[model samples]
Target: MTRTYRIAAIPGDGIGAEVVGAGQKVLQALAKLDGGFTLDITGFDWGSERYRRTGAFMPGEGTDVLRSFDAILFGAVGAPDLPDHLSLWGLRLQICQTLDQYANVRPARMLPGITSPLRNVEAGDLDWVIVRENSEGEYSGQGGRSHRGLGCEVATEVSIFTRVGIERIMRFAFELARSRPRKRLTVVTKSNAQRHGMVLWDEIASEIASEFPDVVWDRMLVDAMTVRMTMDPGSLDVIVATNLHADILSDLAAALSGSIGLAPTANLNPERSAPSMFEPIHGSAFDITGKGTANPIATFWSAAMMLEHLGETAAAERLMRAIERVTADAENHSPDLGGSATTEEITSATIRAIGLNAT
Candidate 1:
């Protein structure tokens, strides 16, 4: 009675394909362990490249395929030639919003052998998660350009907020904070200025804080939050912010930790029947495509996050410990981590560290 989990594998454009290939290898290795479950992966060729070939990102009929999956393992999704709106909003954003994946969770932490650009910080000095409201706020596709043929043409994009969206994301953040070793939650908002939506965010965060009495809670304006992140990131645990704020803060957090190339994220629809989409925080690195130098740890850890989401916590922890072990070993690391090893070398080391054979 082995349970088989169907996963939608979207190896999007550029280095996305490269890193996702590595992630698939890692997942296969995990499946090979003495476990009661196996993975049935269905790869989706839907991205900028596909768009060029088919004039569509993801087919209308293909939505059913995505919905049928147990979970999704996503790669990056942008290209220089395509409009950012077409590459991101039309495809990746459509999937997430349509699926109601309201919580975007990104985890940034210093790896054992990676060094941060920040002064006086040792390896493994940072660990934090940014919980973003994914479905709404500034990301709500609500406005467009006006007077396109006139001299006074203006473009507008409306920012929206709902009580339901705010409340659930806040609750998710508090719950995540409780699960972490350091039980601290920070809410990032621009409530003083962006009164309509951010104020609601603040109100919801305050209400949620009362529910989680054991967790320490705090709030900061987005500007101040950025400054605090660089000066004292260790003091933070879980951070909840609107879509735009969270997007910016998470990138900063990734840099502070080590590299954006090492951060993993989960776009989660907690109430959905299907599992969430897990991916790395970095985008498709077209400049370095096929260079064999892209680091794959982020995608590997993202697979760990996916495992955790699937209730395979023991497997997830084991994978993470293996990642730590590999990173800690200076003799076997990718070039991005200051080692001379190639992508395949580092991935092989990670597999071996987890007691899996690199086949």
Candidate 2:
């Protein structure tokens, strides 16, 4: 029997729509080439524009609607006019936190054709996967303001860390490290200053370290981790950090690898209790919203992650190979990578490569 996977596509805002359009074409090409499975993608017009129209990014039943799909392919989020937090909390966070997608996985590496900013880094040297605690931490939304317009105004933003939350994420990070060839994991924390929650993060990570004896693990303060990431890129393999730290570090990782436009994110629920989400790490670039010059490789890479999450391993690897093949050629590069090719040209090249490609 042929396998059919239901996919939800949320082309959230700005270049999100552009890259998502590219993602759909690449996915269609991949399914056609694989011949073993097919995709049924449902597109939703839920984004900043929709928020402007109805005062909400999506319908009240949005989470209910997403539950039926096997996986979600998300485009970028945010807009020039909307408050960043509102756009984030309104859509992306709503889906992620609601579905309990507690593990945010981001992979950063030197693509074959791209040149790294690091002086002497090679493909294998700078390759790393960053696992972030997705559900809670600084972003748990536990704080509020006290005064309205008084001089003694008080505002507090709380970071919540529970034993259950810390333990699960640490275990997930360790298992991910064990799967990689190097079997090395770097746990990031700010335990020295933020003694409460960050300390809990450290304790749980150490406790989980005992469970994966084969994996070589170490800890780095969030500040020092940045230096280590740039100065000693090769020394790190898999990194685990809190939501805030990982968010910053991953952006730096993307820049070191090549371009921020090349990074992909997987918001995963390992237990498979709900559909996971895959998206590019790049945000909505309002400057290039309709320019047709945005890079589609990140979206393509996210699509590959979506396929892998859906158990279409062969298709996932094939899609990645095709992405690497196209990215390796600078002539087909988008403006972000310092080439002039349009989104259509690069996407077309990727789809063509998929047909001509083999495992």
Candidate 3:
């Protein structure tokens, strides 16, 4: 029996449409190789452009449809011309929060031929995962703006943390640690300043550590984590932090590996009843949307993550190995990876490496 998966394809704004198109092709190629599964990609044209057209980023019923899909393949979100809040909060954040995708998993690793901006660090020496609390903490959307005086406005945003949110994300970190070779987890917090919320987070993380005794765990302050990420990235394996801290750290982790263009992320609901969303960690590159220079590797690797989440582990491994092969090939490379290949060229090489050609 052939199993079919329904994926909500949100190409979003700017280069989001472009990279996601590349990812879709990669997914189709993987499915062709597997032969037992098929993708029913339902395109959802919702983003800044959609907002301009309908005064809404997505249809009211679109949320319902999203809940019904097996998973969501997302592209970048945001446009230079659009207000950041309008594109980020109104669309991307809205869907993530509403869908209860509480675990944001971003994996950062140096690709075979990609060079690091950090001096003396060789390619393929960096690999780490940032497990971010997606539901709350700074991103809880709990604050408002107040007019102080003429030409002045005071904006206050609160970082909300509950036992429910803390424990789950902590457990997620420990579980992830158990799977990786390093078996080390770093808990990032600012307990010295924001005593209440971070203190609770530490206590919960300690409690969870009891369950996974085999895994090594340590705690670090947010500022120190930033410095160590650049200075000593190879020592870290899995890092777990609250929403805002993880948001910042993940980007730093991506930078340690290479270009933001190479990072991939997964927003997992983890309940198995609802579909999780997978996307590249990088935002929409409005400047390079039509230039053909945008790197597609992030989206390709994100598609590999989607395949793993969909229970097609074999296919996922094949896709990843194929990516590694293509990247490791000195002749096939993208500009970001220090080669002159365009987006289409890199993608074509990856597809060929996977032994999938358009028929």
lDDT of all predictions: 0.86, 0.94, 0.86
lDDT of 2 at 181: 92
Angstrom error of the Cα, residue 296, model 3: value is 0.8
- RMSD (CA, Å), candidate 2 to true, equals 0.8
User: TM-scores across all candidates?
Assistant: 0.96, 0.99, 0.95
Give the best candidate by TM-score. Answer: 2
Which tens-of-lDDT digit does each residue in 220-255 have in candidate 1? 999999988888877888899999999999999988
- Show pairs that collide, candidate 3: 138-159
Quote the lDDT for 130 in model 2. 96
lDDT of 3 by residue, 115-157 (tens): 7788887554578889999999989999988886758888898
- The residue-level lDDT of candidate 1 at 201 comes to 86
Q: Worst ten-residue run, lDDT, model 1?
A: 350-359
Per-residue alpha-carbon lDDT of model 2 for 294-351, expressed as tens digits? 9999999999999998889989999999998998899988888989999999999999
